[model samples]
Target: MAEKEPPGTTVVIHGGNYGPSSQQVVCPNCHNRVYTVVKAEVSRRTHIIVILLCVFLCWPCALIPYCIDSCKNKNHYCPSCGSYLGTYYN
Candidate 1:
């Protein structure tokens, strides 16, 4: 038998694909309330433009650092499914 979880405890569950399948971290005390954070996607065009701007503006150091940092820590989440793709520290 599964034990009942206490209220206010966050529970992470695997979300299925389609048909109400969504990852979620729910606070048991809140009765199904879940929380999630999202990150922006960098498109190829945007990447190229950023690179060009770096070169033209003579800010290779700044631009390169930003790109490298962005690439280093990336979190993936499916709001539709509420799944925890991964986490980054630093």
Candidate 2:
């Protein structure tokens, strides 16, 4: 028989470099090998760029950073179970 983990215990599995795109990882929640789903999110760098653009250029130009993937953070999620994996900062 297999021993069960204690309640409230956490398991952390580290994978390879998780960049702005999807990556393969062993899902910590489901224990499955799958590609992570990539989601772009606003980050500190993005916010700083937006603030700088608004002060130097204009409000409309500040919005440009929002549309650029390189200016955002990449969130990795398990495609199988939809559990949050990790984040890659810009």
Candidate 3:
């Protein structure tokens, strides 16, 4: 089920989407700057395993995880208030 937001709350979603670039983005919830990159849909351990596979198993095979949105979606979160902005799907 999808989670619902409370009434009268606004979250600004910018077309300000990008890849894994080192940049600061506007935080809708905090109304200030925040680190844009958040975790992928995959868990931390899963990401580590993927990284290990990319290093050990095969080079090109690493694209499998990198191409998957569940593993690559860049979630944007507010640094000040700890809120979500949006997900950047590559």
Query: All candidates' TM-scores?
Result: 0.27, 0.77, 0.44
User: Scored by CA lDDT, what does every candidate get?
Assistant: 0.48, 0.84, 0.63
Model 2 per-residue lDDT tens digits across residues 1-40: 9889899755444864577787777898899988889999
Model 3 stretches with alpha carbons more than 4 Å out: 1-13, 43-70
- The parts of candidate 1 lying over 4 Å away from their true place are 1-32, 55-59, 62-90
* Pairs with steric clashes in candidate 3: none
**Candidate 3 similarity to native, TM-score:** 0.44
TM-score of 2: 0.77
For residue 14, what is the lDDT in candidate 1?
A: 40
What shift in Å separates residue 40 of candidate 3 from its native position after superposition?
A: 1.8
Model 3 over residues 1-90: C-alpha lDDT tens digits?
Answer: 978889965444476555554346666566785556566665464577578887796766765775565565576666678777666665
